[model samples]
Target: MPHPNQLISLLHLASPALPIGGFSYSQGLEAAIDSGFVTDAETAEVWIRDNLLHVQAHAEAPLWILLHRCWQSSDHAGVAAWNEWFHVSRETAELRLETEQMGWSLARLIAQMGWGDEGLRAALLAQSPVCLPTAFTAACVALGVDAREGLTAYCFSWLENQVAAALKTVPLGQVAGQRILYRLYPALQEAVAEAARRADSDPPMLSTFSPMLGVLSARHETQYSRLFRS
Candidate 1:
């Protein structure tokens, strides 16, 4: 059982207010929006859900777990070691940036908190090429938050950002964005369960098998008139 302070830490780690500069990146929503594949609210919901489940869940989430385990074992070098797989596994440049930038920002923010700075800074300074989940998991642990709570919030926040991106780029209504978020709750829960299961697994196998989505991520890099990064 977790302590009261532990639970409070979990809440803070999971809260949407925790700044990792997530609102700036779209995770490929801009390209999907321009491509007509995600123009409407209904279509936008499907696209976001697909991304959360297929891409982030398998590819990025495992990195979080590995980073958490690395912290637990005090393998500062191991964090840097994981970057190779992050690059090779993720098929596109923009996708890589989205994760790394978010991870880096999260690391920087966590560093200023005056807690868990030693291991976290060492891991980041080693050029870990961290992803959002990687920074998120590390910060959560440093803050005394449990992994499950950390992951739960991470999953929800991912969805929230995508929905915001969709609302702006895809032109989905405010109400529609809420609907999309409401619909994704169950999927997030399922992802949390999956994350828990893979906590010990070594970077589980994953790829964005959604061909159209991958193309959009690639195309977003050159979208001459775009509002968000992939």
Candidate 2:
């Protein structure tokens, strides 16, 4: 069991109000809508759920676990290597920029809040444009959050932001958005579990295999009258 304070810290980090600008980017969902892949609440739920299971579960979540371990052990080299890998893994320009901006924002916030030691903060800032999972994992390690709990929080934050984007762009009603989120609770758990298992592999193998999301995100860069950034 985690200490109450640690759990609280996880909640705070996961909060939608963290000011990392997570709400600004829709992570290609907007393009999905623009392209008619996601229109109503049902399609919206399916879109988000599929990405959550496929992309985040196989790649970002396991990457988060690896980054958490590296941060915990103070392996600056490993951290930088994985950070660069994640940056390269972003399939589109907007997607890449989203992580860079959000990660940069969170890195600065971590420094301002004094969450980690001088060395850890220095190492984190060393990455020219740290990816979100790298920066987020650093905070979790500094704050004493368990790896599993930290990844869970990360996924929840992503899910909440996706659902919020659906509400605005898909124009779903509040109740409908809630229903979408409510239905994906189990999928979220399964995603985290799969991420853990993947991370535990002898040498973790991460996938960036969501081609449709890549295409849609690229399309979003030129999307007309877009509501979200990506």
Candidate 3:
């Protein structure tokens, strides 16, 4: 069991309502819907599940875990290297911008909260564009959240945001959205477990191979009228 304070901190960090501007991004879901790729609740569920398992679990989550370890060990150089790698891994401009913008927001939030060592915070903020996972990991370390718990919360927060985006884009009923989230519970658990295991291996394997999502995000960049930033 986690300490009560740590659990509360995780909840706060993972909350969708946490003023991080996460609500504005569908992460290509909107574009996918407009393109008829995610036409209904079932399809929306499939799209989100595929992303959770393939893109996020294989790529982003492992990085998030590594960032957590880096922050915990005061590995500032490792944090910056991972952040740059994450920036480069983005397949499209919009996708890159999304992470950068969210990273800046989260980093500012952490600074405002007065967490972490000042020197570490300054070093992170000095990065040209802080990525979300790195900023989130730094904040978790500062707040004394366990790396596993932080990673779990990070994944869950992403799951919640994707589901929320689907609710609007897929126009699914609230109950249906809840059902989809419930069905994804196992996948979420598996992703967290895989991320933890991968964090232990040297030269972590990071994948960025979602061709369709990349295309959609690229298309979304010039979408005539859009509800999401990407």
**Backbone atom clashes (below 3 Å) for every candidate:** 0, 0, 0
TM values, all candidates? 0.87, 0.98, 0.96
Give the per-residue lDDT digits (tens) of candidate 1, residues 29-103.
Answer: 888777777778888888888777776676566566676777767676776666556655666898788778877
C-alpha positional error of residue 109 in candidate 1 after TM-score superposition, expressed in Å: 1.7
Q: What C-alpha lDDT does candidate 3 achieve relative to the native structure?
A: 0.88
Model 2 backbone overlap count = 0
Which wins on lDDT, candidate 1 or candidate 2? 2
Over 4 Å off in model 1, which ranges?
A: 14-16, 198-203, 208-210
What's the C-alpha lDDT at position 74 in model 1? 68
Residue 69, candidate 1: Cα error in Å is 1.7
- lDDT scores of the candidates, listed in order: 0.73, 0.93, 0.88
Error of 2 at 222 (Å): 0.7
- Arranged by lDDT with the best first, the candidates are 2, 3, 1
lDDT comparing candidate 2 with the true structure: 0.93
What is the Cα-based lDDT of residue 91 in candidate 3? Answer: 91
Worst 10 residues of 1 by lDDT: 199-208
Off by over 4 Å in 2: none
- Sliding window of 10 residues with minimal summed lDDT for model 3: 196-205
List per-candidate RMSD values in Å. 2.4, 0.9, 1.3
